[model samples]
Target chain A: MSSKNLIIVPIFNEAWNLPLLFERLGALKKSWDVLYINDGSSDSSKELLEAQGSNFIDLAYNIGIGGCVQTGLKYAFEHEYDYAVQLDGDGQHPIEALSELLEEVNSNECDIAIGSRFKRDKKHPVGRTRRLGIRILSSTIKVLTGQTILDPTSGYRLFNRKSISLLSENYPQDYPEPESVVFLLKNGLRICEVPVRMNSREGGISSIHRDGIFYMAKVMLSMIMVVLRPKESSHGSR
Target chain B: MEADNLVDINRVQYIAIAVSVVYLLAILYLIRGKKIREEYSLIWLLFGVVFIVLSIWREGLDWISNLLGVAYPPTAIFLIFFMAIFLIMIQFSLIISRLSRNNSKLAQDQALIKQKLEQVEKKLSEK
Candidate 1:
């Protein structure tokens, strides 16, 4: 049977970028369906998304990035989507990487495929502090799970049916990307990273960019907690 | 001599007992007025009862202070009060977190329902 793919774009106050994002995604060659999750934007993002006439889930309030993405996953799970890809609405994640990510998951090579900026072409120049934070998290995951994930903080990810069910049920709320990698690894789920070109943000600032130090500290603490927490035995989809 | 010192209740102890009684009355009034949920106010009530108990039985406070190696008996009361407040704050934070999660889930569910309803309405109009 052919797999059904759902591209989940979690947006928060990215009205300016939506037009270009919609254009780029619309031009994709694959027949994957798109679902946008509006994370309670104060701007006219909801109206703009509605005008697009695509599938979308509107959150009542700003529940942060993790909650917004998890809502998309829950929608995919309930709708019985075979595979779901989490794409950012900021236009930073290139639509070209979608094919490679979906191909990895479709071939059963890995249950979750991550688009890494550092894999092959290191074109995206990251700030020093943010780069250090990413390094710390990546190293922590390696030490704990014996797996090397190049970009643990990347939002560009594809999840198979099993991962969708598991994450939809229980996902980390704050700073979920790295903690989720640890959780998936501890549960014996296969993860692979594919090299992808990431563009600079076209509009809006990152929610975590303001408090870099504090955010890094919290992420480090969360990584420790993820490792210390007891393991789950069930690996299959519920 | 120490035993007598423990049994002796001073003016400060009387003031404490009076304050505890007033606090307990306020909690009861709030509960009666339906301003505070019973489940949430239970901890406050328990704290008020503990304060009254400690004020009435001065000897018990001294015993506890000595057992815990605290130099001053009043320090023991302050320690317990702060500990209780900290615990109550933690409980409230946990409740807020759970409520936020449920709120987000409800919003997501509502969005899904709205989407399905729209689809059905569109189909009906087409037919």
Candidate 2:
């Protein structure tokens, strides 16, 4: 039997970009099962999903992005998917990179593969300040876990069954991306990055843009906390 | 001069008693109206009772101050009040942490179940 792969798309009020995302995701549906998680969207997103007969789960209320993604992870874990990929709903993550990410994990190269926008690819560039912030976070992760992650803030990621089970159990809630890299590394799981071009969001406000300075400070603090936390004792036994 | 000092102390005592009474009554009213759950109201109620006791028992405040070696008896009131507020704040923080943890877990479970039910329903409909 072929391996079961899942693409978890976490959406929140992305009515404007949903059509294009759905179309792009449709091409992969033949080989992968798509799960759309509606994070209590207040737009036409719910209706759009329903009209298309898309397989999705509507959250009762707005849980932040971390919680939204965790819900997807939990579904992937329960379904026993061999590999799972997370693609943002705002169209920033390129669906074409999914295969490359899957290859890294499928070949036993790493437990988790992150689609890095900065390794060598400069097709899509973030703002100067945002780039600086990600650099600081990258160094922090390096110092804490000795892992050099070029794009710590990149949301485009793929995980194998091992990483999925770990993250689904104890994923961070607020500003999870950077902290999660440290979290996974601290748990003894290998993480590698592949250079991939990203698309600027089609519509809707970026979470970091709303409170850039404060967001940087909060994410930095959370990464420190994750480092200081005790590692799971199951590392040695497993 | 000694009589004036006594009168001032009495005035302070009266103010403390009045404030404690109002606070206690407010807590009772909230409990009666079901505004505060019984589990959480217990702490406020206990604090109100302690406030009333310390306000009326001048000797008790004096004794606590003597025990702590505080120069002034009123300083004892401030210490006790600060400690109570600190404890209550810690309690609130604990409660909030548990609430947020539960909330996310509930959302995750609800979403998964909803998806499963939809899939089952779809399968049934196809039949």
Candidate 3:
């Protein structure tokens, strides 16, 4: 039996990139379900999404990336989907990598599979500050959990039903990607990183560019908090 | 002259008393007008009362300041004011964090309900 997989694409003011994203995902050979989460966009993003007649959830207001993704997970949990794949709406995470992420998750090798840009041999140009921030987060996760996450900040990921349920109940808020990695590791959830190439965003501003130092500090603080947080008793259970 | 000698009434003390009265009146007005919830207004009311008491009892303020080892009594007023402000700020932060968390939960619940309703509506229409 084919696994019930739902693709969650959380969008925020990416009206321009919607058409191209639709085209790329539409070209996929596999018939996968996609849910577009409109994160309280003031732009014509909702109108564009409506025009496509795609399934989507319109949040009342912007609640950041974590809230958006958690909403999708809630949907997946309610609908009883076996697996959920998170794909960014900005087109940075390549649509072609979806299959590899799904394959890993479906194989039952890991409860969650992340698409790591740093795992590949090819060099992706990154800003010095961002590279340093990423390195700090990567090392922090490594030191705390003893698990090396090559791309702790990667938004592209696939979560099995157990993770979907767990995260649906409780998930991080702002800058959640790395912090969530630590949370999952602390909870003893199996994680695997698959090498994937990422394209520079087609359009729209990157969320990380707004507050460089403050964002980094918050992320580091969140990581430390996650490390110190007591393990949940119901962890690793269906 | 006896009462005047007993209380060291000064311009700063008068100003502090006036400010405290105004703050207390403002808080009462807000509560009466339903602008601020009664539960939250309690803290402001308490602050207003403390200010009023400290303004009226100069010697008491000095005694507390001396006990705290603060060199200047007026500086104690400023210090207490700042501490109250800081505590209020922390309270606001906590309230906002809770509100945002609930807001997100409400959004998620609403989205799930809407999706389910749409599905049911579609199924009914097909039948």
lDDT of 1 at A60: 81
Tens digits of per-residue lDDT for model 1, A139-190: 9888988989989999899999989988887788887898899888887789
Q: Indicate the TM-score of model 3.
A: 0.93
Candidate scoring better on TM-score of 1 and 3: 3
Top candidate when judged by TM-score against the true structure: 3
Show pairs that collide, candidate 3.
Answer: none
Runs off by more than 4 Å, candidate 2: A122-124, A234-238, B1-9, B25-35, B62-76
Quantify all predictions' global Cα lDDT against the true fold.
0.86, 0.88, 0.87
Q: Model 2: per-residue lDDT, tens digit, B6-38?
A: 676588789989999999999999999999998
Residue pairs in collision within model 1 = none
lDDT tens readout by residue for model 3, B6-121: 77659778998999999999999999999999988888999999999998888989898998899988889888989999999999999999999999888877876887788799
Q: Considering DockQ, which of the candidate structures 1 and 2 is the better prediction for this target?
A: 2
What are the RMSDs of all candidates, in order? 3.8, 3.1, 3.3
Q: Docking category for candidate 2? A: high
Candidate 1, B63-85: lDDT as tens digits: 99999899998899889989999
| DockQ, each predicted model | 0.49, 0.80, 0.61
Candidate 2 residue-wise lDDT, A147-219, digit = tens: 7999988889999989988888888898889989998999899988988888876876555677888888899
